[model samples]
Structure formats: structure tokens, C-alpha cells
Target: MKSGVFFVAAAAVAWGMGGVVASVLYRISGMGPLAVSFWRAGFGVLVLVLVQLVRRRPVGPRALFPRGWVMIVIGLGLAVYQSAYYLSIAQAGVAVGTVATLGACPILVAIGARLFLGEPLTGRAVLAVGVAIAGLVMIVGGPGEVGPHPVLGIFWALVSAAGYAVVTLLTRRYADRIGSDDVGKTLASFVVATLCLLPLAAAEGLLPASNATVAFGWLVFLGIVPTAMAYTLFFNGLKTVPATTAAMLVLIEPVSALAVAVAVLGERLGLPAVAGTVMLLAAVAAMSVPVRRGSRAAVAAGAAGFDRAAPEPAVAGASEASGDPASAR
Candidate 1:
């Protein structure tokens, strides 16, 4: 459980840095959101395929396109959430975009996990979620310059939230079946996402005019750190953590983003934002606390009833090797 929490938190940190890196790419390269998303996925797939080769895992089309319809959905979800979030940031300011998208995700996740995955919503979990959200609101306070099309930005943010929620729920539901196939799953998703975004990206200009080399370098970073490393850790963590808890942990993304803004970009962190950051961190820490052995067992039993153990040896293998699973793209 501790490891799961650590993995999720670590992934959030990487994702936060990724957002900053994407912003840098946008500034230096003049790449639109679609183009950036495309390159991110495209580069991410290359890295994942390379990793598979290094590990001697199958990189053939058969392995790259496993799991049928669920893989497609996950891939589509990845594309939607990522592109929409970038669009939101473009349309609205980063504060509004990040807050709206990530703030709504945990609520959606909690509701879905309870209804679909049969995960218990304990009082502590509920309180932690509430606190984290309230803190998030405080961090992104006021409606100062919410961009020309605030409504559209907000719409995109909500869409991103929904996409992320679906992915989290689906991933959690099939955690056992996924086993150590994180690389395969992530590679498949990136392959699908890159294909889906290709035309749109091409229309917007796939290559950057200025700082071509630097832009591609950052894009590679976005692929490696955020898309590949972060997703891998997140998927592995999902095997042990509840979807709702995982959702709450993702709040760290914005915090990490804010840190980068302040430190690297010379942005200021106001008193309210600092206090809110503390609250958010505290709430996440509270949520990561393990439940008592009996309570955890009860929750596991309830979840087992909803999720039938598939007749696959990999499922057992995944459970036994809960310490680490092969990663996502």
C-alpha cells in the first residue's frame, strides 16, 4: 500500500514537470496543442517500443495491439484527456485549466469506483477528498484573466476530467488482468492516440519552425518522463490502490507544476497558494494512510465479488509481484 501511494505520488510529480516542459515547448517551438500532443504520443511510443526490445518483450504488432476493445477505449481516453487538457491551457490560463480538470477528476473517480468497482468510500477518504478540493480552489483563487474564451476552456477542462476518470476506472477494474503488461498497454494506447491525433496535428504543423532540435528534445522528455514513466508507475500502483485514492493522489500534479513555475520560471507563490499547497499535501498524506488489516480485508472481499478472477496465470503473477509491474508507455 505504501508503495502504491509512493508510485502514484511520484507519477504526479513527473506529470507536473511534464506540464512545465510542454509549456516550454509551446513557447520555444510555436507548436499548437494538437501537434504537441501528437508528438508527445509519437515519441512516447518510440521509447516504449525501445524499452520492450531492451527487455526482450515482444514488440511485434501482436503485442503492440493486445486486449481488444478495452485497449482502444483506454487509448482514446488517453488522447482525449491529454489533448483536451492542453487545449484548456491554451484557451484558459494554466491555473484555471489545471484546477478545473484535476479538481473534478477525484469526485468523478470516487463516484465511479464506488458504483462500478465496489471500492469503499470511507469517511476519512471522503474528508480527505473534500479537503484536497477545497485546497485546490484556494490555490487557484480568483477569476483573474481566465482567457478570452473562459467558457470554452472550462468545457475542455471538464471533458479532460471525464476522460481521465474513465481511464482510471477502467485501469483499476482490469488491474489483475493487466499483470506486468504495463509497457504493452501503454504502447498500445500511445499507438492509438498518435494515430488518432495525426491528421489534426498535421493540419496544425507537426514540426516546429524555431529551435527544432530543442523542441524535439523537450518533446522526448515529455514522452519519457510523463507519458512513459508516469503512466507506468500509475498503472502498477492501481493494482493495489483503490481508484478513488489514486485520484486524490493525482492532485499533486498541480502542486508540482506550481513548484516548477515558481522555481524555474520565476513565478511567485502567494501566501494563499502556499497555505493551500500545505493543505493539499496534508490531505493526500491522510488519504494514503493504510486502513486497518480487517477493514482492508473486508474491502478486498467486496471488490472480489464485483471483479471475477480471470482464468489466467498472469493474474496470479501480477498479484504476487505487486511490488513492481512492467510499466506503461
Candidate 2:
């Protein structure tokens, strides 16, 4: 449980930073969302491939594409979500866009899990989600200029949220079957996603007009930190953490992202936003507390169909308990 929390929280921080960086990139590079999304995935693929080469791990199609069709769907989903999110943040202010997109995710995941996975939606989970969302409302409602086309931005945000929800559920559903080569899985998905976005990005022009070293550096940082590192950690965490809990844990993104925005983007953080941040942290902290062995939360988790201590399959030359398994398609 501790490991799961750590992974998810760390990923959320990286994602939060990435969001701010992306906004900056937009201003400097003048790149469209499609182009930016393409580069993010493209650079991420390079990093993962380098890791594979450095470790001398051969990522064959069989290992990477455990389920060919599903992997494709996951990759497409990733492309859609990433592009849509960038669009949302571009059209909506970061706070509004992030809150709308992320806030909708846990709700969607919870409903999907209940319907498809038979996971019992405990009352405690409901309360936690409600509290987290309230915090989000306060954060976005506080001092901040609303972006142009907020309604359109929100529409795109919802689309991003729905796409992400599908990807999360599919990953969780197939974690056991995908074996434990999380790195390979993430790499494969990025490869496919990059390919999917390439045509659109090319149409929009791939390279930024500015040749500034700092702009390129930011792009690299976006790929390595958020795209590669954050996702690897997130997929590993999802192997043990239930989908709903993982969704809630990611609410940390808005808090951390808003902090970065205030510091770097000159965004205002009023008292209401401060109070909301505190409230949001409390809710996430509460969610992190381990459920008692026989508690209702524990029972609900058991019903969700994953075991934290479950031994991973023998693959990728890794031991059963040595490291976390891949939860990507």
C-alpha cells in the first residue's frame, strides 16, 4: 500500500510540473496541441528505447504486444487523451481544465469498475471523492482569470477524461495478463501513440519556430520527466492500487500544478485556493491510509480483483517480488 501511494503521488507531482511546463512551451514554441503531444510521445519513446538498450533488454513484439488489438486501443486512447488535455489547457485556464478533466476521472473509473469489475463502491470512497472534488471547486473558483471559450474547453476536458478513464480501466483489467515488463509496455504504447500523432503533428509543423536552447530543453524535460518517468511509476502503482483509488490520488496534480503556475506563470492564489489545497491534501492523505485487514475498504479492494502481495508472473527475467509489474496494455 505504501509503495502504491508513493508511486502514484510521485507521478502526480511529475505530471503537475509537466502541465506547467507544457503551458510555458506553448507560449514560447507556438506549437499546436497536436504537435506538442506528438513530440512528447516521440521523445518519450526515445528515452525508453535507450533504457532498453542500456539494460540490454530485448523488447520483442511478443513481450511488448501481449494483446495486439488491446495494445493498439490503449495507444490510441493515450494519443486522444494527451492531445485533448493539451487542447483543454490551451483553451481553458490550467486550473479549470485540469480540475474538469481530472475531477471527472475518478467518478468515471468508479462507475466503470462497479459495472464491469464488480468492485463494491464503498461509502468511504464516495466521501473521499466528494471531498477531493470540493477542494477542486474551491481551487478553480478562487482568484483566477477564466480562459476564453471555457465551455468548449470543458467539452474537450471531458473528452480527455473519458479517454483516460478507458485507458485506466483497460490497463487495470489486463495487468495480470500483461506480465511484469512495465517498461516495455509503456514503451510500446508510446511508440504507437507517437506514430498515431505523427501525421497530425506533421501537418501542424513539428519543430517550433524558435530555435532557443531553453525551448528545446523544456521539450526534453516534458518527455523524460512526465511522459516517461511519471507513466512508468503510474503503471507500476496501478498494479496494486485499485483504479478508483489511483484516480483520486491523481488529484494531487491540480494542487502541485497550481503551485507551479503561481510561481512560474504569475497566477494568483487566493485564500480560498489555499484552503482548498489544504483540504485536498487532507483528503488524499485520508485515502492513503491503509485499510484494516477485515475492514469494508479491504473487502471492497478484494472485490476489485487485485492483490498487493500477489506474485507476478515469470517473465522479463525478473523475480516475483523483485519489482512492480507493468500495468499498461
Candidate 3:
């Protein structure tokens, strides 16, 4: 494989560590996932800002609020997506929740491609989606996820996953114009999440009840490592690859989560769950399959446009490698 593919794979590995990292923090601080997410965003921004400062790159408005209204609106979806997703994972196990969210994104991408972007739905895309839907049934809505009263937790996660799919599609569409200043977009999303959940976090008493050094340390780690470090690595990985392909690589996250759950949480997946995971993986592969021309040109174009609209130094450095990435899908 080419070196770029290696970067994508590395990204997958980095993203896979997120669940375990978050789980570890939970044990240390006992902070609610929402609070954890909020702190993660807040602290992560500090890291990113410091990096920018050390690089000596001037802070233009783009980095501060790149993409303007469009990014802010997209940020809203992201906030909703993250909030629901974390809640789902907290309520449901990692294996079930991650699959539901990541698995559902392709369908949203396809539908978005056909409608707004005017990309034709090839037979391959259609078939892949159909298989994915069948797989979704078995994994999320199928009899397997059912237990006692119901799996309302997993259901919320499914909704959140669908929402995130839309978020990714929008990012692929708009981030090009926003440029690498896309940090603003991510910040806006996290800010929205924090604000929206402020009331909830307060009500749950998960915000500031902790007084131990362990809790503080975990809070900082949650902010920097999984939330901050993950995204920097995630976007760095994106610079080296295509968005769709990047999305597919993240599928490893669920697998990683499953492994973590089995070893750490002592949870064993049911046979049906495993089968459903296999089907979902197949569906993701089909949906993420590169086009005849390459992976995804439109997505690449959008990323370019976003950079043009709001260029960043790191993104500029990535230009030589990214000018014409083989494919993001």
C-alpha cells in the first residue's frame, strides 16, 4: 500500500483508542459523559490554540469563525449529534452504540449525494445501502438488541448516528470552502454541545462535584487526549486521505470498542450482535467503495473550497500531499 494509506490506517488506530480512553476517565472521575465531552472540547481547543501559537501562524477570522453562518449551522447538527451519541453510548454498550452511529452514516451520505450534490446513485451504491439496511435491522432494530423492557438506549444512539452522518456529509460539502480553519466549525459544534447540555449537566450534578486530583486529571485527559488529541490526529489523517475512506476506517472504532468492552467491562456480545456487526462492516465497505474515477471527487473539491474560504497554516502545509488526494471515500 502507498504511504498515504498507511496514514489512513494510523488514523483508524488512533480513533479506535477513543472508547478505552473515555472509559478510563469515567472510572477515575465518574463524570457524566456529557460533562466529559464538554471538558474535552474546552481543553482540546486550548491545545489546538497553543499549537497554532507555537507555529507562529497569524490567527485570521477563518480560524476563529471559519465558514460563518454555514459552519455555525453545521455546528448545531454536530452538537446534537455528539450529545445524542455520548448518551447512547452511556446507556448502551460501546459495541452496540458505535456500530449504530458509524454504520448509519453511509446511507445519509448516499442520499445527500443524490439530492443536494447531484451525484447519481450508481447501482453499486444502492445495493450497498440495501445490504446496510438489512444489517442495521439485525444489529440495532433486530431481535438481538431487544432485552427486558426495550433497548431505548441503543435507539437513541441510532438516531445520533444518523445525525452524525448528516454532519459528515455537510462537512464534506462545506469544509472545502471553510478551509483548515475548519477548527472553528469543530469548536462551534463543541461549544454548542456544552451550552445545550449546560442545563442537563447541571441538573445531573456531573459538572463540578468532584474535588479529587484524580477527577481533575481525568477531566483534563478527557479534554486533551480523546477529545483534543483524537481530532487533531483525525484531521491530520484526513489530510493524508479521502473523507469517505476516512469514515470507513473509523469503522474500526466499534471493533475496538467491542474488544475494550470484553476485556475491561467483562461483557460478551451475543451471537446475533456479532453477526450484525459483520453485516454492518460489509455494508460500510460497500458504501465506502471507491468510484470508477477514484474515491470521491466532490468531497475533495469541497475540502479544497473550505480551505480556500478559510485557509490555515497546517492545512497549507498539507497542500502538497492533499492537492489531489486519491480518494476520501
Candidate 4:
């Protein structure tokens, strides 16, 4: 079946809960940051495996590791992205960490695409990026959080963004060729991430006791909902949205998180948050609008690549390279 609009919306909805879900898992598991990273991936793989079986799809190793060690290369980046991102948020504080990582990712992805894929950005594109970065700044400082080491958070954020950027570039460059479907690519990332975290999770005593119902439940949700469903929606949406567009659309995640918290979870939305969210969303929307026909073509081409991996002009890419070490962009 043809997929585009539905996938994008679904991904948006699914991933909207990203922060909330991560926070929930943290609350219940009493697990350290590393453990949360490990279980999310491990359980996510398990769920995907089950989903593949239910779909009557054959699960083979063939489509999984094609293009030689490229998956591993990408996977290593994924691991770093995931771990560093979480660490950044944990050590540095979410606001500083989030902005540094997410705000910076698109810039790096654009650069990577230019260098590797021969994609170049126009003046409008550059302006769009700048607007978005400004919005990102507002968002990070919004709600007026103060800390001693904002620099640490910013440092982690940049690292996370860098790592996620690598993941996006790899996916755009190689996913269609290696995996049977985008699911295969996502699975590969999760599997590789799981392996990478096994040792750290083990060392940090991050594994759940299996008998602990609440913790296990949190772990399972981490995988099935945010991990599996989120990626699925992203891939599906990637079919319709341009890589640059999709990456920007992701800015909606933080907004969605705040809305969920305020409306559903009885959290507060301070003036800074509301203002920042508006600015950020506006920036994201502006960044996604293609002023030129070629820019529009980039979006459609990105859609085409879903059916088959075809090259598209570089506008921007949503690299999973977060300042977080654990997340795969």
C-alpha cells in the first residue's frame, strides 16, 4: 500500500509522547540512565520481532546486514547518539541538553548531505535553519531553568545532535538498499544499539528483575510504544515528507510533550514555555516551506525514496544524531 500522509501523522502522534514516555520509564524503573537505554532498545527489538511474525513476514538475517559493515558503522553512531543524548539530558539538564542536541542536528545533517550526497542549501534554506535555531534557543531557555553547568548540557546536546545526524545520513544513503523495509533499518539500529548497551547496562546493573511488574511494564512500553511505534511512524511519514521537512516536523515533539503534560498530566505551562513553543513551532513551519520548485522537488523525491532509495537534493535531514548517546536519529 502507498504510504505518506498517514505515516507522517502517525509518527508525529507516536513520537509526541517521547519525553513523557522516557520520563515515565525513569520514574518506575528506578533504573539509571544507561539501563533505560538498554531496555528500551532490547524490548523494542522484541516487539518488532513479534510484529513481523504477526504480519506473516519472514524475518531473515539477509536484509539485515547488507552493505557489509555499514550497518555497524551506522549502529555505532546510533549507540553513541542514544547514550550521549540521555547522558546529556541527565547530567546537563533537559532544556540545555535538548536544545543543544536537537537544535544543532539539522545543521550537521545538512552539512553531511552536502559533503557526501552533493546536496547544497540555498539562501532561503539557510535562513530557515537560522530561524529554527533561534526558536530552539528560546525553547531551551524557556521556563527559565537555571543550573551551574549549562555548558555541560550544551556540550552533551551538541554531541547528541552530531550522533543523530550521522544516523540520518546513513539511513538516507543506505537504508533502502540494506533492509527489506524501513522497519528493517529501524530494527538494525535497535539491535546494534542493544548490543552496544548490553555491557554498560550490565555493568550499571540496569537489567530488570523480570518479576518486577511495574519496572518490566515500563521497559516493555519503552520498546513497544516509543521505540517501535515511533520509528514505524517516522519511516512511514518519511515516505511523504522530505528529509529536511521531516527533520523539522520533529520539533513538534517537544511541543507535544508540553501539551500532553499540561493538559493530560496536569503540568504547568509557564509563559516562557508557551512563548517558546509558539516560536519554535512557527520556526519549524517556516523552515519546512519550500520557496522554490526545486525545494518542493526535494520533498517529493524524499517521498519517492521510500518506495526505492533514490537520491534527492539536500534541503535538510532529520538526523537522529542527538547530543544524547543512547538515541538513534
Candidate 5:
């Protein structure tokens, strides 16, 4: 349990730095969001592939392909999530975009699971969603300090949140079939995302020639550290921790991003926005707390039933696994 908590916390801290890093890249390189997304995914795949090679693991087509179309869907979802998230930051400012997207993800995922995955919408989940949405309204409607286009940014951020929710659900459902090799799954999905975004990035052109070196450095940092390493830690932790616990621990990402935005980027929030952020985070925490006794038993029964209906394992792996659906960005 301690190891699980530690790994999750470490992943959160790494992910928390992602926004700040991207913000710096935007300011320094003047690269478009799509361009940044392309490089991040591209370099991330390289990093994962290299790691797998170094570890002497299989990286062949047979090993990398996910069962059926799961990887394709996850790949497309990732492309959308990454692009929209960066665009949200570009339009709304790092602080608001990160908070809105990350803050809303768990609530969206919870609602999605209940509706499609046959998970129950417990009273706790309902309250959490309500409070979270209320908080979102406050953040969106409150004064805008992050960027000039708050509404547009919020829209994109919500899109990112939805994409992330979809990916999370699909990954969890297909995890056993996706194979036991997390690195291979991640690399394959990232490669798909990279290919999907390549054209858009090309249209925008690569990093500015003058800032090429510095920009490339930051892109590599974004890819290797936050994107690759963060997910590695997250997946490792998921081996021991319950998905619920890991989900809650990852809330640290937004808090870390918020701190960096204020301290490093000179961002500020109004009273209402601050209150809204608090409410949103509180809702996430409330929903993540483990239910006790009777409710726990009920949840266990539901899970057991769901497992019975799920397909037999297509590959060998841990039953419960978690990955940062947004590439930890």
C-alpha cells in the first residue's frame, strides 16, 4: 500500500509539471498546439520504444498490437485529448485550462462508467458530479485572468476531459486483452496518435529555426519526463493500489499545475475561481473515498457480476491497472 501510494504520488508530481513545461514551450517556441502535441507524442513513443528495447522486451507487431480495434480507438482519443488540452492552455492560460480539464475528468469518467459500463451511480457519485459541475460553472463564469478567450478555452478543455474519460473507460475494459506488456500498449497507442497528428503539425511547421534547439530540448523534456516517466510510475503503482485510490492520488496533478502557474507563470485567480477550484477538487476527493461495509459489499457484488460478463483474458496481466489517460499531461 505504501509503495502504491508513493508511485501514484510520484506520477502526480511529474504530471503536475507538464502544464508548466508546455506553457514555457508555448511562450518560448511560439509553436502551435497541434505542433506541440505531435512532437510530444512522437518523442514519447520513441522513449517508450527505447525503454522496451533496453529492457530486452518484445516490441514486434505481434506483441504491440492491442486486441482488435482497442488501440486505434485509444490512439484517436489520445490525439484529441492532447491537442485539445494544449489548445485549451493556449486559449485560456495554463492554470485555468489544466484545472478545468483535470478537475472535470474524474467526474466525467464516473458518469460515463455508470451510464455505459453498468457501474452504479451512487449518491456519493451523484453529489460529486453535481458539485463538480457547479464548480465548473463558477470557474468559467468568474473573472478571467488566464487568457483572453476564457469561454473558448473552457470548451476545448471540456472536450479534452471527455476524450480522456472515454480513453480511461476503454483502457480499463480492454486491459486484460491488451496484453500484460504496458510499455508495448503505450508505445503502440502513442505511435498511432503521432501518425494521426503528423499532418496537422506539418501544416503548422516545426519549431522556429531560431528557437529550434531550445524548443527541441523542451519538447524532449515534455515527452520523456512528464509523458513517459509519469505513466510508467502510474502503471507500476496501479499493480498494487486500487484504481479508486490511484485516481484520487492523481488529483495532485492539478494542484501542482496550479502552483506552478502562479509561482512560475505569474497567473492569478479571482476569489470565485479559487472557491470553484476548491469545490471541484473536494468533489473528486469525496467521490474517491472508499465506501464502507454495506456499500463496499454492494460495489464488490457489482464488480463480480461485471467480471463474469467480461471476456476471458486474451492475454496475461494484472486484473486492475491504471494509466494516465491523458498521457499524464
Candidate 6:
């Protein structure tokens, strides 16, 4: 349990630092959000590929490709999630953008799960959705001076949240069908996302110059540390921790991001925005708490499905655990 907690917390911290790293990359490299996103995904795929090789695992076409159209959908979701998130941060400060996107993830996931995955939506979830939305409104409307084009930033954040929700749902539903390989599904989805973003980055003239060593360094850090390592820790920890517990712990990401924004980047939020942040986080917490007796059972079943479909040898001891939908953010 202690180890599980540590891994989850570590994952959250890594994810939290993602925005800070991206902001620094932007400042130092003058890379657009899409360009940064492209490199992040590109390098992330490389890291996953390396992990596969080190594990002596097969990285054949069968393992890397999704069985059907499900992978394509997941890949698109990944692209949108990454692009929208970075774009939001570029427009809004990291604090507001991270809070807005991560705060709304659980509510959106609940809705997507209910509609598409046949997951039951408890009254608490409905109330959470309402409260979260209200909080989002407060965050978006609180202070016009919060960020440049705050409204647009909020829009991008919401889009990122929605994309994350869809990805979570799809991953839960099709994780079993993707094959019982070691992070094969994850690697494939990232590869697809990288392909999708490459054209956009090129068209925007956002590709990193060959001589931009510093930008490449930052991009490599973003991909290896946040994108790959965070997810690896998260999934490994899921083996010993309950999905609800993991979900709650992952909230540390936004808090960490907020702290970095204020301490490192000197960003500030108004009183209303602070209140909204509290409300949004409260809503997510409320939703994460299992009020129904069947909740644990359902989660267990989902975890079993994932294990049966794709058992990751790298975390074999911790492979029986279920996933937190919002963790995908």
C-alpha cells in the first residue's frame, strides 16, 4: 500500500510538472503549443519503444496496431487532449488551464462512461457534474485579466477535458481487445498521435530546428518524464491501489501545477477563481467516493478485463489493478 501510494503520488507530481516544463520550453524555444505537443508525443513514442526493447517484448505490427477502429479513436483523442491542453496553457496561465482541464475530467468521464460504457451514473455523479460545471463557469468568468484571451483558453481547456474523457472511456472499453502486450496499446496510440500531429507542426512551421539543442532537451524531458514515466507509475500503482484511491491521489497533479505556476512563473488567480478551484476539486472528490455497493465490484471487473486483455510484464506484480479514467489526463 505504501509503495502504491508513493508511485501514484510520484505520477501525479510528474504530470503536474508537465505544464511548467512546457511553459519553460515555450519561453526558451518560442515553440507553439502544437509544436511542443508534436515533439512530446514523438519522443514519448520513442521512449515506449525503448522500454519494449529493454523488456525483451515483441514490438511487432500485431502488438503495435489496434485490432480495429478503436485505436484510431483513442489516437485522435490523445492528439486533441495534448494539443488543446498546451494551447490552453499558452493562452491562459498554467494554473488556470490545468485546473480547468483536470477539474472537469472526472465529470466528463462519468458522463461518457454512462452513455457509452453502460456504467451506472449515481446521483452523486450527477450532482458532481453540476457542481463542477458551475465551478468551471466561475473559473472562466472570474477575472478577465487572468490570462490573455481567458475565454479562448477556457474553451481550449474544456475541449481538452472532453477529449480526455473520451479517451478514458475508450481505453476502459477496449483495453482488453488491444492485446495482452506490455504497454503495446499505449505505445501504439502515441505513435498514431505523433503521426497526426506531425503534419500540423510542419504546416505551422513549428518544427524544431536541427540546431535548437536546448528546445530538444526540454522536449525530451517532457516526453520521457511526464508522458511516459508518469503513465508507467500510474498503471503500476493501480495494481495495489483501488481505482478510487488512485483517482483521488492523482488530484495532486493540478495542485502541483498550480504551485509551480505561482512559485516559478509568478502567476496569480483572483478570489473567485480560488473559490472555483476549491469547488471543482470538491466535486471531483465527491464523484470519486464510492457511495454504491456495486462500485467496487464494477471497478474490479474492469481491472480484470484489462488484465485479461493486456498483461504488462513490466508491472506484472501490479497488473491486476483497475484504472482511474481521469488518470489519462
Best by lDDT: 1
- In candidate 3, position 106 carries an lDDT of 57
Indicate whether candidate 3 or candidate 4 has the larger lDDT.
4
lDDT (CA) for every model shown? Answer: 0.74, 0.71, 0.51, 0.61, 0.65, 0.63
> What is candidate 2's lDDT per residue for 124-178, written digit by digit as tens?
7888888888887776663144568888988887888788887777777777666
- Estimate, for each residue in 33-83, the C-alpha lDDT of model 6 and write its tens digit: 677778887888899999999988777766677475777777888888777
lDDT of 3 at 190: 52
Tell me the TM-score of each prediction against the true structure.
0.88, 0.85, 0.67, 0.81, 0.77, 0.71
Give the range where candidate 6 is weakest over 10 consecutive residues by summed lDDT: 314-323
Best by TM-score: 1
Q: What's the best-to-worst order under lDDT?
A: 1, 2, 5, 6, 4, 3
Predicted candidate 4 versus true structure: per-residue lDDT over 254-315, tens digit per residue: 66655655666576656665676777677666755555687657644534434355432100
lDDT of 1 by residue, 59-168 (tens): 77666655667767888988788777767755775556666777778888988988888888788888998888778766766444466777898898899878888888
lDDT score at residue 38, model 3, on the 0-100 scale: 62
lDDT of 1 at 183: 77
Give the C-alpha lDDT of model 4.
Answer: 0.61
Q: Kindly give the stretch of ten consecutive residues in candidate 1 with the minimal lDDT sum.
A: 313-322
Q: Residue-pair clashes per candidate, as listed?
A: 3, 0, 19, 28, 0, 1
Segments in model 2 whose C-alpha atoms lie over 4 Å from true places: 87-96, 142-153, 262-268, 296-329
For model 5, how does the per-residue alpha-carbon lDDT over 78-116 read when each residue is reduced to its tens digit? 788777876776687655675577666766776666666
lDDT of 2: 0.71
Model 3: how far residue 108 lies from native, Å: 1.8
